[model samples]
Target: MREPRIGIFGGTFNPVHIGHVRAAIEVAEALGLAGVEFAPAARPPHKSGDPLLDFALRLDLCRAAVSGIPGFSVNPLENERPGPSYTCDLLADLARTRPGEQFCFIMGMGDLLCLAAWKNGLGLGRLAHLAVHARQGQELEAFGRFLDHNAKAMGAAPTADPAVWSLPQGRLMQYVPVARLDVSASDIRRRWQEGKRIDGLMRPSVLDKLLTHADALPAGWGRPPAA
Candidate 1:
């Protein structure tokens, strides 16, 4: 039997933006993934302060953001679970549901650096192959060092470590070229508060919900500051 070509894109998605969606699509296409699942962390252990939106609302926005996108869907794995969510735990759950499936864990360069600090970091290599998106101006050599430093203790396959996982011919991180976007979730939330139009930034469904719950969002939601 053929292995399932699955991609996992996880994030806080304070307010899902076009950039986030674009990144997922670009990676999925490049990897020839059969499907991509966007998992909004229920309560990110790494986030210092409280989430801007309630767990239910965050999940709703995530679902709306990828509603029409083909092969893209939101999973409630993290949100449904109690307590702070960990990537390792989430991957374990996925492995149980889809036995023998080959999974690809999609994340950014920054995430790879923090992998060693995550729970069950060593076991992750057994769950999925790592596919990290390169950050702008970030050298692959530096990333490779990070992997080597962390994996040496855990015994994770050095070759599978995204930091060192480069194509022989290219001598580059197996990267999927994508258009970089400057849009940030914080910026998006800020714009909504400043009464700026968010036509192209967020999905209509997500925008509607944000507008519906304007009062619950951060300080300036849907209202401009006094000039």
Candidate 2:
């Protein structure tokens, strides 16, 4: 019997938006994942300077955003764990709990470019496949080169195809194409702070919830206006 394929989609998800939902759908479909778990980080090691929304609020928004979506659910592992949330640790925990399942870490092109900089990034491939989502018109030649170098390091023959690469320890790296959305969480927050409309950027349920609790957010959660 074939092992169940699962995609791990992790993010701060300060307020889950449509762009995030769309990317998850695209990646899950492209990779034929049995399900996609949206893991909200309790404290992202990479993100500093600004404070994130409360973990409970972020998880609630995520749940609302993915509601009714087949094969989509929110995972609060990071929130429950102590200390900084690292992808490597989460991957390891998932491997331990879900043995015999094929795990894929879904990320964006920007994240792929900085994978090596991540905590224990080199060993991440061994824990799960890297499913990178390439936005429309984004140049991926650099990513392809990085994958090729890793493939060669793993003693695997490099291929011309940039979509998939063989890695050490029975892992794989795949690039999945997805529609580019100009929306970003920072931008969404900024718009909200400035009393601007963010109609299409996020789900109505999420936006409504945020609106209902706007007063509770930290002071100046969004970026400050340019000088």
Candidate 3:
């Protein structure tokens, strides 16, 4: 039997916009993944905000965004937890809980560039295969060289380790290009703040909810709800 392929794409899902959905869908297809889970970070270590919508509301927005999508679901592991969401911790739990399944931690090239700085970065090579998406012209050579330089110093790793070291000594990595989109949650928030139309910027369902619940969000974010 073939191993179940799972891709974990975690983020704040601040508004669960269309760009995020596109990326998830594209990566899942590119990697031939059985399913892709969007894990919203409960409290992202790298970000500070009013959380515009409370946790439950944010989760609800996420659920609404992917309502009819196939092979896509939200994993609340990070959302339910209180502290900062660390990728290593999440991967480890996934490895143990789903022993037989093959897991890939999906990320953008920007994140890959800073992977070495993440907690337990070296151990990540052993936790799950790293799947990164890049834009058409984004150079990945630096990342490749970084991995090549550290594969050995990192010691024996996991998941296709043998193949990893076969590449240049400092380039132990695999990359796949996925569709790129201009939509960003930050931009969405900014547009909302300016009272700009967000049509076609997010999933229809999510947009509706955002419009309906605009009253519940923090002041100065997006458009204010009708008086």
Best by TM-score: 2
lDDT of 3 by residue, 1-227 (tens): 75767888877777888877887788788778898888877767777665455667777788888889998887877765557788888888887777777777787777866777878866675777667677645555654666666667555332453223332222223566656688888787877666678899888898888778766765525444454
| RMSD vs true structure, all candidates | 4.4, 2.9, 4.3
Worst 10 residues of 1 by lDDT: 166-175
Taken over the whole model, the C-alpha lDDT of each candidate is 0.72, 0.81, 0.71
lDDT of 1 by residue, 1-227 (tens): 56656888888888888888888888888778888888988788888474467777888888888898999998888866777888888998888987877677788766767777788764566667666776444557766676566554544434554444533222223444466777788888777668677777877888888778766775423446655
Runs in model 3 deviating more than 4 A are 49-52, 153-173, 219-227
- Listed in order, each prediction's TM-score against the native is 0.81, 0.90, 0.82
- Model 3 scores worst on lDDT over the 10 consecutive residues at 163-172
On TM-score, the stronger of 1 and 3 is 3
Decoy 2 TM-score against native? 0.90
Give a tens-digit lDDT track for model 2, residues 172-213.
778788898888998877776776778879899888887777
Displacement of the residue 90 alpha carbon in candidate 3, Å = 1.2
